[model samples]
Target: MSNEMIKCTNVSFKYIKDSEGDKKEKYAVKDVNLEVKNGEFLVILGHNGSGKSTMAKHMNALVIPTEGTVVVDGLDTKEPKNVWDIRSKAGMVFQNPDNQLVATIVEEDVAFGPENLGVEPSQIRVRVDESLEKVGMSKYKRHAPHLLSGGQKQRVAIAGILAIQPECIIFDEPTAMLDPIGRKEVLKTIKELNKKHGITIILITHYMDEAAQADRIIVMDGGSVKMEGTPKEIFPRVEHMKKIGLDVPQVTELAYELKKAGIDINEKILNVDEMVNELCQLK
Candidate 1:
C-alpha cells in the first residue's frame, strides 16, 4: 500500500550543445525511474555533476524531461497548461537563501507566492503566519529579511514555499550555504515538516549525514540510479560508495573500521549511538 506522490517513468534529459555537430547532447539523466510516496522523506545523493540537481528541477517543472515523463500528484509536468499548477504542487527551495528572498520584510516575502497565485489578502496573512510558525520563524515575521541569520534566512525561504500550501517540497542542496548551526536549524525544520506535518520531502544533498536522516536514499552516478535503499542498507557498503566518489557517514565508517580490527559489530551503522551500542556488545 503506497500513496504515490511523485512518479518518474523512463525519464531522460539531454542538453543539446550542438544541433548538427558530432557531440550527442549532454545527458543529465537517463532512464531514471523513481517513486516517492506521500509523506515520505526521500534523499537524493550524488557528487557534483552527477545529475542530482537536474532531477530536482524536474519535480517542479523548472526543467521538463526530454524523454519520458515526470508526474507530480497526477499532473504531468510537461503539459503547458499544467505548468503553474505543477510548480505550486511541488514548491522548491534552492541552495542559496539570499536569492530566494525577494521582499525586504520576512512576512512580505513569505506572502509572495500566494500573492502571485491571486490568493486573497486575508487568507495570505493566515498562510504566512502559519508557515512562519511551522519553520519556527513566527517571531521573525516582522523583522527585516537581510537582518536574519543564514539559518533564519533559509527558514524564511522555506516559509515562503510552505506559504503556498504545496503538497511536496524539493530541496536542492538547501543547506549548503549555511554554517553548521545554520545547517542544523534548516535540517530540523525540514525534519519536523516531514514527521509532524506529513509534508513530503525530496532532499538533494551531498552530505551523507544529512542523507542518513532520510527515510530512503537514492544514489546517482552518471545520471542514473546506482543504488537505492535505506541509510542502513546503503552506508554499509563503503567500498561501493567510495568507488562512486561519495563518502559514508562517519559513524558508519567507524563501525566498519572496528569490524575490520576484529571487533564483533554489524557493519551498517547510521549514528554514533548505534556504534557505541555495538561496541558495548563486543565479545
Candidate 2:
C-alpha cells in the first residue's frame, strides 16, 4: 500500500468570464504542488480568497484543476472513471451543518451517503449506527436534526461522511459558524477521528488555535502557498504571519513579544501551559 494519500502536481484553476466584454481571468489556485501522507493531520490557513478552499475542492474531485492533476490514493481525479473512487476515499465536510443535512432524522442523514453508494441495507444499518457512535451521537439516532444544537448537527454531518468509509476527510471551515463550545466539540471529534481511526484530516480554518493542533500547517495567500511548516516553526514567524493577514495563537504571540523584550522564553510557545512553564524556568 502507498503511504501517499493525495498528490497535487503543478495544479492551477482559473474562472472564465461569462460575458464577452469581461476579458479578465482570475486564478483561484496557481501552480500549486502538495502531497498528503496517509493518516496525516494537515491544516490550511489563509484569509478570504487565499485559494485554500479552492485547493481543498480538488482533493475530492469536486473541482477539477484546469492546468494540472490531482491524484487521490493513486487515482487521478480528472479521469471520469476515477471520480467515484476518489470521492469515496476523500469525503468533504463544509462549513454549514444545515446545508449538509439531507434527512430530517439523524440516523437517516448518517445513512444517506452509504445508501447512495449502493451499500447493502444491513450494512448501511450497521454503518449508520457505528458512525453515529463514533461522533457521540448514537443516542440521538431517532432525534430530529433541526432540534439539535449546532455542534450536534455538525457531528451528524461528520457521521454522514463517516458512513461513506472514506480514508481522508476534508473539513473546510467546519467550525466557522460554531460557538466556542461547538468549535471545541467539533475539534475534539476531528482529533479523535484522526488519532483513533487513523483517518487523514485536511482541516481548513481561520482559527489559529485549531491550526495549532495540526501536525503541519500550510499558509496560503493570493492563490499561492506562502508558508508551510509545523506549528512551532510557522507560529514563531509572527511578523510574517501578521503581514500575511493571519494571526498566531495568543500564547505564541505573547511569547514572541516577550522574546522581543529580551526574555528567555521560547518564541514557539503554542499554549498557555508551555508559556507558564517557560516563565517559571526563567524565574
Candidate 3:
C-alpha cells in the first residue's frame, strides 16, 4: 500500500463570473502541485481569498480542478465514479459547526454520516459512541446540539466526521468562527485525532499557533503556493511572511523583535517554553 494519501498535480481552479455581457474567469488556485502522506499532519496557511480552502475542497471532491487532477487515497477525485469514495475516505469539517450538524441530538448528528454510508444499525451505534467519546462529548450525547456551547457543538460536528471512520480529514478554517475557548477545544480534538488516532490531517487555518502544531506547513498567496516547510523553517522568515500578509507565531515574532534589539535569542523560537529555555541559557 502507498503511503501517499492525497496528491494534486498541477492543479488550477478558476471561478467564472458573468460580466455586463460576457463571462470572466478569476483564478482561485493556480498550477499548484502537492502531496499529503498518510497520517501526516499538514497545515495550509493563507490570507482570505488565497485559495487554501479551494485546494482543501479538491481533496474531498467538492470541487474539481479546472486544469489539473486531484487524487485521494488511490481514487481520482476528478472521476465522477470515485467522488463518493474519495469523500468517504477524506471527510471535511467546515467553519461553521451549525452548518455541519444534521440532527437535533448530539448522538444522532454523530451517527448521521455512518447511517448515510449504510453502516449496520448496530455498528452505527458503536461508531456514534466511540466517536463522541474520542471528542470528549460522550456526556452530552443526548443534549440538543443547538443548545450546546460553540466549542461543544464543534466537537459534535467533528464526531460526526469521525463516525465515518475516514483515513484523512480536511479542516477548512474550522476555528474561524470560534471563540478562543472554542478554538482551543477544536484544536485539541484535531491534534488528538492526528496524534492518537494516526489520521491524516490537512488543516487550513490562518492561526499561526495552529499552524505551528503541524508537521509541515504550506503558505499560500495570490492563488499559488509561496512557501512550504516545517514550522521551524517557515515561522523564522518573519519579514517574508508579513510581506505575504501572514503572521508568524506570537513567540516567533517576539524572538524576531528581540533579535533586532541585539538580544542573543533564536528567532526560530516558536513557543514560550523555547523562549524561556533560550533566555535561561543567557543568564
Error of 3 at 130 (Å): 0.5
Please state every model's RMSD to the true fold in angstroms.
1.7, 1.1, 0.9
Over all chains combined, what TM-score does candidate 1 have?
A: 0.97
Candidate 3 lDDT tens digits, 4-95: 99999999999988899799999999999999999999999999999998999999999999999998999988789998788889999999
Q: Write the per-residue lDDT of candidate 1 for residues 1-283, one digit (tens) a residue.
A: 3489899999999997766666667899999999999999999999998999999999989999999899899989999999999888899999999999999889999999999999999999999999999999999888999999999999999999999999899999999999999999999999999999999999999988899999999999999999999999999999899999999999998888878998778998899888788878876
Please identify model 2 stretches exceeding 4 Å from their true place.
Answer: 17-20
Cα displacement (Å) at residue 75, model 2: 0.5
**Residues 34-148 of candidate 2: C-alpha lDDT, one tens digit per residue:** 9999999999999999999999999999999999999999999989999999888999999999999999899999999999999999999999999999999999999999999
Clashes of each: 0, 0, 0
**TM-score to native of every candidate shown:** 0.97, 0.98, 0.98
Regions more than 4 Å wrong, model 3: none
| Superior by TM-score: candidate 1 or candidate 3 | 3
Q: Is candidate 1 or candidate 2 better by TM-score?
A: 2
Q: What's the lDDT for candidate 1?
A: 0.94
